[model samples]
Target: MQKIGFSGTLDPITNGHMWVIGEARSIAEEVVVFLSENSTKAPKFSAEERKAIVLASCAERGWNNVAVQIVKSEYTARVAKRNGVGYLIRGIRSTADFDYENLIQQTNVEVIGGAKTLFVMPPRDLGSVSSSFVKALEGPVGWNWTMKKFVPAPAYKAWILAWLRKEWDSLWRERPHSAEWFERLTGEQAYGGAERHYHNLDHLVHGLAEIRAWAANTGAAPAHVALVKAAFWFHDAVYAHAAGEVSNEEASARLWLGSGLEPDAVRAEEVATLIRATDHFQGGAMLHPLKDTMLSVDLAILGQEAEVYQAYATGIRAEYAHVPEADYNSKRAQILAHLRGKAEAGTLFADPFFTDNYTAAAIANMSAELALIAGR
Candidate 1:
């Protein structure tokens, strides 16, 4: 099974690129789309954002064989060679595109031994549509229906949601207590905040999914489940970039309590206790059943498969990017050591669900992370 590579900035994936990816998928067993960064061009979107857009586009179009990756190197040839891609796929629109790509093809072949370049013309209707042209439509005038036609539907929806985030205040005023408002506020704090990397909306969503699964499995009461859901939303709402300096759980709890959204004092306290229980290192006395469940769900990431755990570690490091490597590693090791101690003592999770399913894997992940941090 030969892997074909397609490398592009993909700042905002266009319809043309989707068509080209579909064409490439037909020609190769696997199509790897390298979201390459270009030093010469100022990207409208970050590398991570572009990769996500491409991935979403692939998923939307049901391109099962296509995979999206963010290239560390700006050079496409280097990306192809690193990924063991034998052929580089390029989409050519016109004579000008052919001439430019022809030069690139020769250079790539020269730099990467045994690498071949394949050019495919996009559908005639979308041939001239490019990311640059699509970006031009996004100005003070804002995106219109015509602009939506040029880009993938998922990309356009993401763009519109991002645009809407800036106008959240107006939207909030119009629909207070609405799910959209709740999502917008949570999304802003989690995904749009500067410090968040791992404790983002995606993490919150994962927690919610786990909580729901556990609740259903255990036949938890509706009120108890609702409190758990609230705790999930506020657990990492106020993430602290610096380690051991401040308590994000406490801060997040306070934010939720003072938000004028809580039903009553008792319920607020329950949710607050649940959020604070996520402070795994503190090892405080548990007061509520939901606390045990929430804590288990929060630490579930530790029990994920190796690749998922690695990704979580990477995101945590990114969150603490401001800290020096040595300092970060030392702090991280201390945290992991505490978790390891709990796991060793058989007190990591009070909930049977987590004890039966996650305890062993969590301990294993902690041990691996501790060893890695020790070397650093």
Candidate 2:
């Protein structure tokens, strides 16, 4: 009853492909290898030939519960579910592949309710070996490229090409300013979520807007403004289905690098580092360049007048509504704890506007909110 499925086309499976299958087989009671067709990519063999080769390969290795079959449909999840398979396996070789594959896994869940995708990282020795590289050299270089020795007989080169092509298409097509792109890239929308989930595009934009206003009021340095604004947009770039604490920082760097911002690499790196520093809410002790940036971002929420604070705060609550109640509560507590801890340590607000008039205002605003939960 332990059925596992692998969907690919074996034009010439590589050693990396075979390694993943070997590892998958050890963990599954039965392995169903599905040779996918209807691919718009290079194919060196017919689907029937590839299926037979896969069967022979599994048999040669004496692997039980290994069956090779063809799936004509494009839906890998539907095929797996029909076969009573519970696991969808993918092979990851690099960070780029991981990012691309992670998106697919998230989409699969949406496409097929309860379907899961598990990625197995290829061993370091085989990390750089891919079918594409081999195929590109096979014809002109006159090199033998039969993947039977390295890949399972059922491995489909066409399927991998299609997967890569699809990923590339999506990546190239993504619009930086499109709400549709935002939904496709991340499960969350720019606005309207739970209180604990308030950090989104709108929140980031709001934070930057406030940063600009605070800068204008205080005559802040231009470099500080640019760094802060870049961090605001890039901070959430690496968000995935199961993002963790450092997701913001990681994504920031990825976005900066992908955007070919290398000439400003130092500043971009500093921006990423500053965003990470914001996670710690100690008032003034934050790292040099970004400590002020963090205060600006934080104060942007609580330093406003009562009317402005209430209006922004309402939107903040809605942005986080999708977050589970428990998670929402925990994050809210963390933010509050950070604020309290920062104030106690004398690091909460260091900028001129905050140092002069907004410091007490920010504290008073959060104090009221904290008191609401403190008594509960």
Candidate 3:
């Protein structure tokens, strides 16, 4: 059976809300609704009241297959991860909503690592219905004016009353959390408007994949694994490609601390260190105790040990396909030279499995990739 989860404050249920839930039900055998608690910046509704309204609204439609409750704490992603719910559900009504929702989904994937997102578009008729509009006395007229046009009267009344008391606005209009904040502040340009040579969705996926490979090969200590994974996310997070001075270690550490991940400050710092160690020009003399795994990851790419490296290159080429070939060639050359030096010096990666074999594999792979790129 599929276990699906729903999040958000239901200050008032709107036709749009119901439509998403219906879509979720069609895909999974069970739908679990977790009401969001209003933070200082969110709307002002108690968890219990929101739960009641959600249950009442679901009952009106005989949605017995769904289990409704409040999601505790501000860490909704953590809560959902603990529950073993793989998919986080949301409904999109317009292009604006899609942009915001996309960031939330991206952040969850970053923090949780394994979760996926499912976006269900609102039913055609209820496309414009939203909790914010329902709550605004002037935004949209009587609930039935739209409800009868899209939703049942009872459900519509339940939705409006929930919002009338100002409960739903708690989660709405709040400052976005981590990933959301990143997307809002950033644009298509990576650094100095150089068009971002690296650090894209593909980079993130590659980091996670390398971490996964390391975890599988050596079963590294769990704490170390978590730290490494988190580092994979924060590293290169502050990319200013044009300046060529981004600190995967320093900036990522600050990001972790700023995001309230201070409890693991030391570990976060270590990961940042590892990220910096991945710098092609950086040598092993400055390596730290965590250097082995970090280097292993860096070499995993520098050495082109697997198809992952090629994939990374392919993504970069595609992203900058518009750039002048001369510019691409110059940047690509510097990157390859950096990789070659690291591999040649036996410092590109730290091999945890045997201290030699893993490094050897990486060097061999990277050599072939470098040669291929040069010939091209």
The C-alpha stretches of model 2 lying farther than 4 A from their native spots are 1-197, 237-246, 280-290, 311-334
Question: Where is model 1 more than 4 Å wrong at Cα?
Answer: 1-176, 179-184, 242-246, 280-286
Q: Mind giving the per-residue lDDT tens digits that candidate 1 earns over 201-287? A: 446555665766777778998788878877877777777655555577777777778765665788888888888787655537657
For each candidate, how many residue pairs have backbone atoms clashing (under 3 Å)? 0, 21, 6
Single out the weakest 10-residue window by summed lDDT for candidate 2. Answer: 139-148
TM match of model 2 to true structure: 0.41
Residue-level lDDT for 49 in candidate 1: 87
TM-score of each: 0.55, 0.41, 0.42
lDDT of 3 by residue, 279-324 (tens): 5445344556666776565445444435545555675676577778
Which ten contiguous residues of candidate 3 have the minimum total lDDT? 164-173
After superposition, the stretches of candidate 3 with alpha carbons farther than 4 Å from their true spots are 1-198, 244-249, 279-287, 302-308, 318-331, 334-338, 341-346, 354-376
- By TM-score, who's the top model here? 1
lDDT of each: 0.75, 0.60, 0.60
Error of 3 at 221 (Å): 1.4
Candidate 1: residue pairs that collide? none
Candidate No. with top lDDT: 1
